[model samples]
Target: MKIQLQTLYNEYLNIKWKRGLSPVHTEPFEYGLYEDDSADLFLSGHSEATFTNWMSELRPEDPYYGSKPNGMPVLADIFNQLDVYDELVLYYLLFTLNTTMSIHTHNSYSEMNDWMKNYSFFQLAQLNGLSSLNDEQKGELRDFFFFFYLYTHPVNEETLYACSFREQDLIHTKTNIKLEHYFSAFHDHYSENRDKYGEQFLIAPHEIQACEQLTLELLRIIEGKSPKLSMPSEEGLEAVVDLINNVEQMLQMYAKNRTLVFDVMRNFLADPRTGLYRNHCFTMLLQNYASYILYFNFDEIHALVNDFRDTPAWCGIIINKIFTDAIFIHKIMRKNAIDIREYPNVIEFFDEQAREFCL
Candidate 1:
């Protein structure tokens, strides 16, 4: 049965998003597989742009190049599009503790939405008319130590964590992780240091090719059994390895996916290749996703780590690095003269989160 709108809104608070229609709390359900069922009504009445052409339903000017049911105009699907939803979902994740888009910041998520609807076009005009500076000035603007940290200081560092990603194929390929090699290394280390660390390393396949297994066993185990859920390394040992693997995967994806890579490249190219932002951005972004991806990974990890509350320190070294990289992105966007501020929610999110994840 189709769920009611109010009911869905309540469910969103619980991080319950619908499949196909919604862009709600999604995770690494099964590697590359992804789905969300949020009804388009969550964003009802927020559609002001009146874009008929951008809809997914319409045919491109050339039928040979573009075609079919996806060709149908999705005028109502603006907020439903992946790119648009990525921004909001990222925004939802950054500011609030809960996974869903709340009614207000602290006072109310619902009130915030109501207030935003009345936000004037005149105010938007004021923001859009601003001029751009050269790269140096942009760099200054993106500084966390200067802009954000000054804005929210004395929060001091917390625990650290390292999150990483790798495709199963790369683990066996020329990339960083060789297949099964990590398990072996971790096993040897744990075996030798049994007196110092009582932890046991475990391994699982990234891709379970058994179509019969998902419904039959994995669900029962995850839902019924308590699994280990810590960062896996306190000294940045395995975490560092995962970090390296994750970075390699991002680079690989960048090399393979020219569109997104070039979007970043063009942003970087806007400025002179001298600043810290331009130099190691690949590393910077690698660090960012490593932490953010954890949004989806943390609960599973938490369930796994439920038994080990006082385990070794957990600091997100990678999370902090992501902040710096994001600042660089915002700086470059400013330097290159993009109207990113119009997307305040996105800018604000990157601004608020960049340095704060220093754990």
Candidate 2:
């Protein structure tokens, strides 16, 4: 809820009453102080002596306290006027739900179909602002107060952590699957207008510089060394240096081999022989690239490519091998009559997650 001084004051008064403090005069301030303690009003009004003189007989610690008039106003009466506080609380709660609902947020809003009746807290808040908060706003406050908790609290909350009131119908698109196409189109357009780009072809020199740093880092990670430029051993160092030299030579060799490089990428995606190698590489490449964007460093991708390329073939081989192993494992386990579906929560959540990702 949007924090406000008025509500804070009301809550503060509530806490005071709970602590057994006197919050109000036996009569309204309109009548001023009671006749018995009339002189105690302004002489340091908050002093212990001030409280003692006015309420000393009713004091809980007094020797004969039970006989006193017990002249304090009830907490329920002071707290009964809380429309302003309730409205502010509901608005803040709804505001939190408006964020973190994901792209599927619009899929379940219909559940709040009675939002117009119960959730007019948000509406009236927008219309009249807090100025309309008074005895008249009580009906609106009571209706919407509970729903502020209901709709925003996720269904199957053991799975979802954030507060997200879902919308009625969620529309899914192949956004992630299409990222490759978009990035490739951008690269192609950039390549076509190299003259216009002038200093922007960003080839040759960048490849050389990036390769130098990337190779040293890759060698360190490949050998499981710390992040540094030092090559620890002569034998391993020579192999590392040679790999860099071959990669540079291959770059020059492939200068006119755009067709070959692209064919490699396409096959890498399609898994011409089997899908496991390509899938593993896909995970490695994707995780590395995602981390690179966030961290703005080559360490992640460089380490990923290093470890991923350790097999006989690069990306395509690992993906195929992993998938083959997974399928074999599944079949053998099934033959023994042990079903993975026995773990219902894991199975269901993963199935739904797969559907969502594929969607």
Provide the TM-score for each candidate, comma-separated. 0.17, 0.15
Scanning candidate 1 in windows of ten residues, the lowest lDDT window is 154-163
Prediction RMSDs, each to the true structure: 26.7, 30.8
Off by over 4 Å in 1: 4-101, 106-252, 255-262, 265-288, 291-321, 324-359
The residue-level lDDT of candidate 2 at 188 comes to: 41
Measured by TM-score, the strongest candidate is 1
After the best TM-score superposition of candidate 1, give how far the Cα of residue 195 lies from its true spot, in angstroms.
58
lDDT of all predictions: 0.27, 0.28
lDDT of 1 by residue, 181-281 (tens): 32233224333443553222111122111211222222111111212111112221333223332433433443465244334433433434353222333
Best by lDDT: 2
Number of backbone-clashing residue pairs for each candidate, in the order shown: 36, 16
TM-score of 2: 0.15
